[model samples]
Target: MEISPDAIIILKWNGIHINATIVFTWAVMVILVFISWMATKNLTIGPKISRWQNFLEVIVGYMRQQVREITQQNPDPFIPFLGTLFLFISVSNLLDIIPGYQPPTGSLSTTSALAICVFFAIPIFGIAKKGIRDYFKHYLEPSIFMMPFNIIGDFSRTLALAVRLFGNVMSGTLIVAVLLLITPLFVPIVMQILGLLIGQIQAYIFTVLATVYIASATRIENKPNKIEQKEGSKENE
Candidate 1:
């Protein structure tokens, strides 16, 4: 029934305290890293593969495909970042089935931190792909008058991303809690299943939005490249 994991303070020192969000976030990271290591410890390409290796490969391939479809850029470069984001959020959402666990994602702080990461990543990826000059020039698109608006758009989008995730996750947890209190058994079970579905959808959505934003930032210059390539083809013909 806790709204935020901040309610669950694990330690206090010098008037500072570590909360459930921090603890659970760390737990999620450790669990994910450990599972990955264990699963891929004996990966092989010799035809006879372990089920774990197969499962890992399938998941990785699916994520890579998703990145490629979204960005139209090389997926390998983006996979590690986007893939980890999707996996962490999805796994955090799925873990809600465990009794007496509060998903760290239910916290606004955590979601905002994630959103901030994406906000910074957009510029980092854009600059790397296009260059700092081109990336900044994008903010002045259509005219210099739009620069302030564009900067505002940047912050507003980050806020939206964070709030969107926080609202979905917190609302899901709230609904489940109410169901548990009222029906307590059968109804809550069904809601739990539905919540899992919603959680996964949210994960995909968050990842796709992130991919789209990065792609928009980086791909602006590529349009001219395509046009020139087409023009060159016509000249050769």
Candidate 2:
């Protein structure tokens, strides 16, 4: 059985091969774009909103709230990047129910690409919030000797993100495929449903982790003033 959508070639011309991963990834993107257009083309603040619009608003609101809670700051700036990550992954995984449809996220390359985006986004958001100098200064916190370790930590976490997503997605697909071969018909069906749940969960986890990393990068440490410390000490006394 094919372990990755990247191995399934759908087209070939002039020594170039197009795989299922590319096709399905584009398919998911088109579906999202089309649905988004249809839902918002007639957007209104009035009470007569469509169901799709209402559903999308709820999702967006939840995401914004989560970001707010995590960063303790305005969520507007981070929503576009983080929202797209959540939506893309969630939709990709949710569509696994369709027969013969391979989720692009099942591919290591895709997950790695997503992880790399988060990796770079960390510094970008950090630098934007704290300025280039202030952001990089944290890597040397307490001592200049820790700079290499801090840098390594960043790369390690990025690698973890990629492997975590890729392994979960690929394993789920593999389990369903193997069950279909040896198990009864109903068994595979049940596993498919479970796979769907796992997929949604993985998407949520990936998004939450990305949000946390970005939040950490952008967070401002507000140390209490000496006056406040004295006031608290006096209160205790």
**For this target, which candidate reaches the highest lDDT against the unseen true structure?**
2
On the 0 to 100 scale, the lDDT of residue 58 in model 2 is: 98
Q: Against the true structure, what is every candidate's RMSD?
A: 7.1, 7.3
Task: Compute the lDDT for candidate 2.
Answer: 0.87
List of clashing residue pairs for candidate 1: none
How far does residue 55 in candidate 2 sit from its true spot (Å)?
Answer: 0.6
Q: What stretches of model 2 exceed 4 Å from their correct place?
A: 222-237
Q: Give a tens-digit lDDT track for model 1, residues 81-156.
A: 8899999999888888898778888899988998999999999999998899988998787799999998997887
* C-alpha lDDT (0 to 100) for residue 5 of candidate 1: 85
How do all models score by TM-score? Answer: 0.91, 0.91
lDDT of each: 0.83, 0.87
What is the RMSD, in Å, between candidate 1 and the native fold over all Cα? 7.1
